[model samples]
Target: MPAHRPRGAQRLHGTLPAARVAARATSPQAGGSGSATAGSGCVHSRRSIQVVAFRGERVAGRISSGDIEALRERADLASVIGDYTGLKRAGTRYKGLCPLHEERTPSFTVDPARGLWHCFGCGEGGDAYKFLEKVEALTFPEAVERLARLTGYELTYEDMSPGQRKALGRRTRLTDLVGEAARFFHQHLFTDDGSAARTYLKQRGLDREAAEHFQLGWAPDRWDGLVRHLTNAGFGQAELVDAGVATRGQRGLLDRFRGRLIFPIFDASGRDVLGFGGRVLPDRPPTTAPRDGEPPKYINSPESEIYVKSKVLYGLNWARAEAQRRDTVLVVEGYMDVIALHRADVRNAVATCGTALTAEHFRQLEKFARRVVLALDADDAGFAAADRARALAEEAGVREVAVLPLPPGEDPADLAASGAERVEEALADVRTAIEFQITHLLRTANTSTPEGQVEAYRRTFPLLARIGDRVLRYRYIRDIVAPVVKLSADRIEAELDAADQEPSSSTAVEVAAAPRPSEPRDPQLRLERQVLQLALQRPDLLPPSWSKVGEHDFTSPASRQLFVALAAAPSGGLDDVLEALPDEDTRRRVRALALADLPTSDSAHAAQVIDALRRAAIDREMAEVRARMDTQREQLSTDERRSLAARIEELRRRRDAIRDGHEGG
Candidate 1:
């Protein structure tokens, strides 16, 4: 959960007061479901009901149900979910492998009609906010704030009470501080004190336009320059520290960035600054000597409340649209490589921040493009990095991974320095990830004899085996594998057969729609689930007898809880009932049941199902009585035995009546 900040005392660097800012009502941008309009309101917390008195339109400052609904209306759920996983149309809904869980087949589904999703495989389900909460690990308020930004809606809390505002103010302030710090660093780069940093940029072949475009900055040699500037601007030292701009020192608070070139890090939205990546000057005596606490080459801000290194890509803010447009994203090594690529016209480049290519990073990029081109150096370290990248990409289920072959002794930054056209030309001839792996191995293998050829094949066959597509895998075997090993394509194909290795297609894998591994095996539990599933799927078909069904009649604990929530719903809508559920997991189950395809709504079939559950309930009660009698037979007095016998008989009668298809009630 993100830390909560209160308003008023919470000061962000650039955010203006709600009272001073005008509410500009605009339509939702492209890729959204639609515009947030007035009158549509929704309440998130349990026990909260739809109150029509307040409107979603800009009020004095308090957030309204209408405002939330309007935001919800504008966010397209399928499109948002698609950003996290590959979704293919499945009837009116969309289905994809759940990013929330590991599975061979896709069971995650998104209903564009309702702007909701549910995964039958993992039983995770929710609307946009809930999806964001689970996928991004965001709190409710944070999710709301993100949606508001995505929809380009201006939010105000003037109508909210002071206490409520205070609770929400800290986050606002931290974000503001980062934004202010970015501006300060950028402005400082042009000042007289930034002469050395400016010269460094020039030597790298970067110009003024490049610096401003990438929001490049320079931190002065002194410690308190940024500290004093931010504090004088009404931000406290504590706030600066919290935002990762400053660190606690022996004396007091000290700036985290000093005597370095700064690159502001932003989240994918490109709106708020999350942290900074700083590069030490080349000419300066290393501040990161063995005795010094600094790193020798580069240092990024420590992970804080807002900046999560694994989840962020350095140039994503500027490169996402271009990556999507080109259907490819270029993965680079450093901030300068990304900036240099962008400086040349290769805009679809992003870098990992002082970290290895993580599975999460690949998952994030997989959403943008079907293919990823790793633009790494052509050195031993680069080859190792490429191999690690290939493994992570495979783990994340990325469709294609290609390695950009750079000239020996050159990096992307070095190549980009020449011209954009040269970079583009190099990109034109790229090797598939498998080909790169094979080439890498052959270069190391002593393939001067039959034994050497066999060794090379032994190493390369595993790489080809990992390729998911059968056709593509064989193509690589024929085109690249057979010639290298001095064998016909049939011989290599026979080797694959002898090895019993088969390629796995990501799209072909299927997770059967049956009882989930976690589902209860008790017969009555299935009955309870079936009844709830029907009612959830076709709530309108709920007969008047639904009022007679009680939570105690269900055997499954989760099912009983959902039954009570559904029976208590005022609107009888799935969303309304979902909002009323007691906990998130239970709500997720309800959503899964609601979204599942089940028997059609029919009064007769519903009655039969209801009666079956009633019979099961009576049998359960009778079994309990019989068990009591068997255990306490010797201990019971005459009167007690008689009473137990009578109770058993009563339950038996009820069970028999329900078994006969008569209404026990």
Candidate 2:
């Protein structure tokens, strides 16, 4: 999650306030995911030594600023990192494909500084403290705490001793402090002062169970109340400021949110409180006047280390598993609506965080379910969002998009407040994408005028054409033309013909006549990939048995690099090499390739992949030879044909130079 910051304590979608002014790891201009500076090897932590410091990396008593760095240097970074990735070697270092997701090649890089190793793949660097925070998925403080326990040490204010490793910086402690502050807010919500927010929830139809399930909270009107409470809890203002919970003002540091209805935001795991969303108690329409240029309602936690607006969908962490189980995702427009739906037993409902859907969002949703039900407000903006979402999802290959229309002037919250049945009724009668678009077009058309009728056709055809699936296109076309264009069946048929006709006949001919050329490759590639995967699974396989002569002929740039990496990896296993892969996706791709090496159900699939690659190489070469022979026959006379035959025999002899005893194809 990219940390988002607000201009005047106001919030933006999918962003949390930024912290850690460390050297900007990568310039935004790099134009890709993963940021690593030149000359910086993959940073890492020594996992072999278990010490539970504050968050759980080193012993609290023994940890110093330098100690973390030392631990990283001393720890076998390659060994510890291999657990998450498949590794190989570059010239001087071990490399691996990243494990975060999938990739066909390695980007994870590692350095064997005494106690730590670093992963360039995910832009994570540091010692055991850092590794735990990055890979083991521990907060810095949690990693410190874990390490402290492991080393049987206690935390103190003593200055870090000289020569201690450079664990991650103190910023990690703030994540823990934010968790504490979230607990503080939840506690305050149950107090008498929280009566209004609690009442608001209850009146909106959220029962006690739903309230507690969402961990609803309240913030007092006073700016400094939260600050005071956190102070008494032993957290410093610096930590709170970093968490975006408090800030340093002209007079003094004070709470970031006050006098609002607080909703704690959780990570995708449904475990960590990454940020908060607060709906101003006296919520007003966006058009309302504000005393200090504030938005009329709905303020979110500022950009912090934990939130990125483009990524976070409010209520999704809790709804994903449910959505997966139901095989459908219900989307509403506001936070309270999600609460209402969940309370009403529709656990699969989620909402955007005060932002419209984007392509990034649709792709994320596709991971869990294909069915998307958009429950936008009945207003023009809501309808526009629905249209945009339908087009976006269709472009991304989603199978179904259903648009549910809310009652006029009623948002999801209002509909739910009126009655859950009305909400359910609307959702239950969800309109398929085409029908929904056509109905909207009809409603908007001015049928009284001839111009209006023509305008209707203009609006309708474009919508129909956007539906990519050919099967669905005609289904929608039938629905639209049935009432409007049906009077002239031949004309409608002619229109369909116009649409079906190629825009450029020459282009169409070129597409149709295109030959499917086989990829030029060698069987050695698959064998090398398999060998590297096995070596990654168990490094002991890397002694003297591996040979590079057979696999170097691979043509895919990425796979070839991986092969070369494994063949040269100095001391680490394939895990080290994979940990070196720069992104989670690349690592996962390598894993997908390596799944062939695993003793799992996909073993047959793996075999198929290897066989396919090797076979393609042979088939391609054979096809080339046949093509040459045909050309040879076309241009040669009788005497030339005999000479060509002699040349063919020589080519055959060269082809027969295979090491195996079997005859060449």
Q: Which predicted model would earn the best TM-score? A: 1
* Local distance difference test, candidate 1: 0.67
- Candidate 2 local Cα displacement, residue 240, angstroms: 2.1
Show where candidate 1 strays beyond 4 Å. 1-154, 157-167, 286-295, 378-380, 395-397, 501-665
lDDT of 1 at 42: 24
RMSD, every candidate, angstroms: 23.5, 25.9
The lowest-lDDT stretch of 10 consecutive residues in candidate 2 is 20-29
Q: Which stretches of candidate 2 lie above 4 Å from their native place?
A: 1-172, 283-295, 394-397, 449-451, 484-490, 496-665
Relative to the true structure, candidate 2 reaches a TM of 0.50
In candidate 2, position 621 carries an lDDT of 46
lDDT of 2 by residue, 357-464 (tens): 666667666766779888744444444555557657865677788878777766666766666687678777788765776777767777767677655654565455
**lDDT (10s digit) by residue, model 1, range 79-101:** 77776799999789898999877
Query: How much lDDT does candidate 2 score?
Result: 0.55
